[model samples]
Target: MTALTLQNAIARTEAGRARAAELAVAMNIAIVDAGGHLLHFSRMDDAELGTVDIAIKKARTAALFRRPSAAIGEDSQPGGPLYNIESTNGGLVSFGGGLPITDEGGRTIGAVGVSGGTVPQDVTVAEACLT
Candidate 1:
């Protein structure tokens, strides 16, 4: 139960889609395994093509770090510890919109990423999927 099943990924994606619909935002969503490998993906009809790679990268960032992508972003600032982190990992996305998906015991099993909206909005949608 720790790792997300295909059904789990789908449900998560659906939840994110529902949340994005509520906000009237079209989004590109991605789900990745604990190893940061992609599992499933969805791009809304109106989602921008530009966000596709961003969504996947966000998912990978969260999965690889076992933390929210924004957290990495925060520490990657000018004088932060992860300043050059974005340059590594094949160009990770440090901004918001990425989150680790944990099990009931609080261990990250996978991650979800969302894009095609403002940072806050992307976070909101990403959180929705994890719920």
Candidate 2:
């Protein structure tokens, strides 16, 4: 199976971080490999320290599940088998603003995460960088 190179992961993560900062998001950004391993991270100076763990959790959840964490939250609705799935992983965040990064061929390669801004603001930053 093909994998996302570490270099690309770092580049994308940094790009996302920069975009967020440029937007005055004051955020923390993180990238995780396909296997949910952290590949890169950047926390803006104005961001809260607590955002660090939230960003990592978002990246890990997206990478490990190969989907956006917001989708995971959707799947975890009441009466759904995935309900409360977040409880299974102490470091997983099933919230919005986390998205999986896919390869050119449309296969999941990794994930990018952002925190410290509003959920939509974080999503906007991530989308801006990826697009």
Candidate 3:
């Protein structure tokens, strides 16, 4: 399987950042390899200071789980199948801004996450980077 490269990570970060700008929201963005290792990150000026770790955690959660973090978030709600799962894996972020990065072969090569915007806006920005 092909791995995510630094160049691609940087490109993706820029793309996400641009989308966040278009949304008129400052953001903290993170890209992580399939192994949940951070490959790139950016904090837009005026982004919420608290969102930095959240962005990284979201990317790691998506990369390690190979699914959008929002799905996990849904499942983790009360009475859901994955209830309390957020406590696992050194704290997985179950939120909308995290998405797996899939390759042409349909393999998840990495993930991207954005924070500091509303959940929908964050998701939109991250999705823009994947396209």
Candidate 4:
């Protein structure tokens, strides 16, 4: 399988940034390979400092789990099967905004994460990124 290339990562980041701009929100975007290694990152001019790490962790969470991070969050709620899963994989951001990037064959190739906005906004931008 082809690996996640810099060009692919940059395209996703740019798409995400455009979505954030359209939403009138500054955001930080993180793109990671299938193995959860960061490949490309973007911090919009006014994005919060705290969002940098949060964005990266979100991408890592999605990449590691091969699903949207929010799915993990839902399953990890109190008394759920994956309770406390956020404490694993060096700290995961199990909230909305992280989504696995899958190829046409349905293989998870990477992930995109967006932060520096509300959960819904972040999720929207991430969705646009993968559009």
Candidate 5:
């Protein structure tokens, strides 16, 4: 019902980052609008450099596909219906830590992604942002 503005993205990213800190894991966080355009991003000190791109990809994938990237990852495994789907869309990141951000009207407004930690840790941080 409403656009995902930069202010909203920044607040979400900060919440996610705080959760990551509490978990004692550095993280790279990304937030993107429905169109897969970046709204905000943050890479915590000591976070893995490589996860910067992965975080962005996760956010974009979640926003574009309108689902958790973890679900996509599960479906994209061998013998699954979405097998090899990751190879499409210039490389979709079908992994954990990507989650669609829904508005009060239950419409997807954007997405949040977390990386630089283990899958579970990343998922936890990402989910924390939704609260």
Candidate 6:
């Protein structure tokens, strides 16, 4: 299977950042390659420092787990020891606004994360690129 490249993640990150800024959401956006390494990231002019770190963690979580961060959030509830495993392994964000990017063959190749906006708005921006 073809693997995700840093270049692709960078492009997607740029697009996601542009989209987030256009929407007037002061957010931090991050994109990670399939290997769960940071590829590109951006913070809006007025975005908070914490948002940047959270966004990166969110992207890494999605890429490393090969699922949306929201899914992790769901699994993190009571009776889900799996959530603990995810966190222990690192790169797990149990929150919304993180999405995995899959190839045509349905293989996840990367992930994008957006923060510093409402849940709906963040999810909307993240989904915009996943599509």
Q: Give the TM-score of candidate 2.
A: 0.87
Clashing pairs in 3: none
Stronger candidate by lDDT (1 vs 2): 1
lDDT of each: 0.95, 0.81, 0.92, 0.93, 0.91, 0.78
lDDT of 2 by residue, 1-131 (tens): 46767777667767777777677778888888788888888888889888899888988898888888898988788888688898876767888878988888888778888898989888876675465
lDDT of 4 at 6: 98
Candidate 5 residues 2-115, lDDT tens each?
Answer: 998887778888899889989999999999989989889999999989999999999999999999999998889999999989888777899899999999988889999889
Q: Which stretches of candidate 3 lie over 4 Å from their true place?
A: none
Error of 1 at 25 (Å): 0.8
Quote each prediction's TM-score.
Answer: 0.96, 0.87, 0.97, 0.97, 0.96, 0.85
Q: Give lDDT tens digits, candidate 1, residues 1-131.
A: 57789999999999999999999999999999999999999999978989999999999999999999999999999999878789998989999999999999988899999999999999999999988
What is candidate 6's lDDT per residue for 1-131, written digit by digit as tens? Answer: 57767667666766776777778888787888788787777788888777887788888888888888888888687787564654565546778888888999989888888888987778877876665
Best by lDDT: 1
Stretches of model 1 off by over 4 angstroms after superposition:
none
Report the error of model 6 at residue 41, Å.
0.7
In order of listing, the candidates' clash counts read 0, 0, 0, 0, 0, 0
lDDT of 3: 0.92
Residue 12's lDDT in candidate 4: 83
Tens digits of lDDT, candidate 3, 66-113: 999999999999999999999999988998999999999999999998
Better of 3 and 5 by TM-score: 3
lDDT of 1: 0.95
Candidates 2 and 6, the one with greater lDDT: 2
Model 5 regions more than 4 Å off:
none
**Candidate 3 C-alpha error for residue 55, in Å:** 0.6
lDDT of 4 by residue, 1-131 (tens): 56889998898888888889999999999999999998999999988999999999999999999999999999899999999999988999989999999988889999998999999999999999898
